[model samples]
Target: MGQIERLADLVVRAGVNVQPGQGVVVDSDTAHLEIARAVVEAAYRAGAGWVEVIFTDGPIQRSAVDHATVEELSASRPWALARIAEWRAAGVASIGLVGDPDPHLFDGADPARVAARRHDEVRARRDAMFAGMRWSLVAAPNPGWAKQIFGEPDVDRLWAAVSTAMRLDSADPVAEWQARTATLAARAKQLDALELTAVHYLGEGTDLAVGLPPNARWTGGGLIDHDGIPYLPNLPTEEVFTSPDRRRADGTIRVTRPMVIAGQLITGLRVTFKGGRITEVWADEGGDVIRAQIDADEGARFLGEVSLVDRDSRIAKAGIVFHNTLYDENAGCHVAWGQSFPWSVEGGLAMTPEQRVDLGLNQSGVHTDVVIGGDGITVTGTGPRGTVDIIRDDEWVL
Candidate 1:
């Protein structure tokens, strides 16, 4: 089978693990219809009860972001929200196929307005679905994205890189992923046994500390939903992650890879935290956009998650900066702002939002990750037993 078809099969059968008689939802941009169609076909072949495709248009979205009134921009279509709710209520599986066809679509737009206009209601609905449904995010390469990365529209090259990152090249991709997930699960168990009180990051331009709650637990790879269906949230995931105590982070850290945020490429991004709230931000480019996003809401300034990945990650080994968080964040250690996952701590989902905030779990409409691991980076975990090296020279030590 061709790579696209193979990827469709992987996403349907392994990524979201669409079971027989289950409904499936595929969300994609118009530019990605090829892969979206493949996913629909694969889902049906797997005996899916139904498959729905929601196609988005990038240029139209850009126009809306640039010209729409604040109220209009913030408003979400009731039907869209209702559709997701219905799917979630029915225990459906979802696949999000994302690849920005125009990475710089809003480069000259007003960053503050763009930040102010985020669809809060839509985000809440999506978060609710995330907490209950089986879902996966997969990439769909397009000429525009390829041109942004390589200075030329080489879709074939982009496809090859994406396929490799997704492990589509493996003789048995499903089995390979299963083995990889088992290994990551073992690593997560080791970190959990440490009972770490805090993690300290040391490297050039980075000397930061992130505290962990007593109930924090590390997890990676596949996750089992309420119905016992296992799913991979990201096609090329590598990091084992946990929510940090949002009230306890401090010090400064530098981003090692460029981040494409809201159609702007942010480079040389540096941030300082005091009492878990972002106090300062600097970047060689797109600092205004970063500031605007951090100021979006009350909890947007706090740390929501801290994830660790070593140099040996598949994405890191590939040595390509995809400029997509779903891929780049997996290449190294990364930290997120806003919206912590409830599954990161024991009984987290059951806790009320206020109760979770009391435990230092951050809450907000934004969840953005910035990669921060590379050569010379060292991560140490501190607990009752003293400090233990968790990562050294960009490699996982224990």
Candidate 2:
């Protein structure tokens, strides 16, 4: 089989684990039509009852942002929400092909509108996340993404890097993932054993304490759906993460690497927090976009996730910044300020919003991750017994 077809098969069989009689949703950009089509075909081959493709056109989105009223843009298209709701009720699987071809398509538009989000849509999607949706996100290489990485459209080079990151370079990529995910799962168990009350990140201008409640569960590798079906929610996964108490983060953190938000690259970002709420945020580039994202909602200013990735990550080893969160966030330890994964907390999935808040879980319409740990960093866990190191000098020690 061709590489794309092989990749599609992996996405269908392992990514979301399309089951017999299960309907599937494939989300893609216009630039990734081929990959989406391949995934749809693969899903059908995997005995999916039906496969649907949802396409997004970047240029048209740019036009809307440039001319559409904020109210018009904020509706998030009720028809789209209806589709998601329909899929949600039917228990459909979702697969997304990312790696936008034009990261700059929204540049120069009103950053406010560019960052404007529909809370209704965000809440609906979050409701289906993991258990309800059984989703996976994988990258699709294209000329624009390649150009951003290498200053030229070298799709072959981009594909080579993606293949390596995704472990497709191995003779048995699926087997390799099984082995690697086992290791990550083992590490997660160790962290869980620690019964950590909080995790401390110390480095350069960073000395942040992210609170991990007693019921917080650290999860890595693949997620189990409602039916106990295992599915990889993200390809090239490397971080063991948990939903932290959104009310406990404190200190300053210097973003260690660049991150992309709303098709804009943010660099040299530094943020300050007090009692878990973001008090200050600044980035050398794309500052407006990042700031706007922080202002998306009240919950957007608090911590949702704290993750640790060792130096052994293939994405970091590749020595190339994919400029995509799917790859870059795994390059090292990262933190997200927005909606926390419900399953990351024990019983969180079934908790009402009020109950979640009582447990310090964050609920928002936003979830943006920024890398904060890499070289010269120290990660430690502190609990009732004492404190122990988890990662040092980019190596996992727990």
Candidate 3:
């Protein structure tokens, strides 16, 4: 079989682990229809009872962002949220194919409007689904995205890098992924055992500290649903992450990778945190967008997650910036603002939003990750045993 066919199989059998008689929902943009179709076929081949595709038009979304009024931007489509809730209630499996064909589609749009346009109600429903349902996120490379990264429409070259990052080059990709997941799980176990009070990051242009909740659990690779079905949240994932106390972050850090948030490429980004809130934001470009996003809600300015990745990551070793968070965030250590993962803490999934907030878990409609790991970076963990190296020179030391 060809690589695309193989990828579909891997996604169906390994990523979401589709079960017999289960419905599958595939979400993708027009640029990724080819892969989305393949995923549908693969799901049916895996005995899926039914498969549905939801297509999103980039140009239409860009138009909305450019001209929509504040009321329209903030309005939640109840029908849309209801559809997702119905799927979740039916135990449906979901597959997301993401790769922006035009990463800068809304580059000149109003930053504040763009930030306010996110569907807050839909976002909350999605978060609830994540706590209970099975889903997978994977990439679908296209000519436009390839051009953005390599300065040329080299689709084949881009596919090659993606295949490597996804471990599709392995003789038995399924077995390879299983082994890789085990390794990440072991690393998470080690971090959990540390019972670290805080994590300190030091590097050029970066000096920050993040406090962890006592119940936080570092997790990555695959997660099992309530019914014991294992699902990989992000394909080509390389980081082990935990939810940090929303009220304990301090100091400043620089973004090591360009982040494409809300259709804007933000570079040279530096953010200052005081008591876990984003107190200052600076960027060579797109700072307005970052600032606007941070002001989205009361919780948007606080830290939600902190993840660690080593230089040995497949995405980092590939040495290509994909301009997508699912790929870039895995390439290095990163931190996010808004909406902490419930699965990252003990009994988190069952806790009420107010209870979670009281325990220092951030709550907002936005969750944005900014990478901050590279050469010269060092991370140390502090606990009852005192400080110990967690990462040195962009590699894991623990």
- What lDDT tens digits, residue by residue, belong to model 1 across residues 95-120? 99988888887788888756665465
Clashing pairs in 3: none
Q: How would you encode candidate 3's per-residue C-alpha lDDT over 142-247 as one tens digit per residue?
A: 9878988999999999989999999999899888889888888888999888888899999999999999987788896789889887778788778889999999
lDDT of each: 0.87, 0.87, 0.87
Q: Which ten residues in a row have the lowest lDDT in candidate 3?
A: 117-126
Clash pairs (backbone) in predicted model 1: none
Provide TM-scores for the models. Answer: 0.97, 0.97, 0.97
Cα error, residue 29 of model 1, in Å, equals: 0.9
Q: By lDDT, is 1 or 3 better?
A: 3
lDDT of 2 by residue, 1-398 (tens): 76788789888887898999999988899999888889988999999999888898889888889998777777767887897788888999989899979888887889899998778887888787744688899989999999989999999999899888988877877788888889999998888887899999998878998888657899988888777888898987999999999999999999988767777778899999999999997878898897888888889999999999989999989988888889999898999999887777788888888888888989889988888878888999998779999999989988
In model 1, the worst 10-residue window by lDDT is 117-126
Which TM-score value belongs to model 3? 0.97
**Deviation from native of the Cα of residue 189 in model 1, angstroms:** 0.6
lDDT of 1 at 396: 91
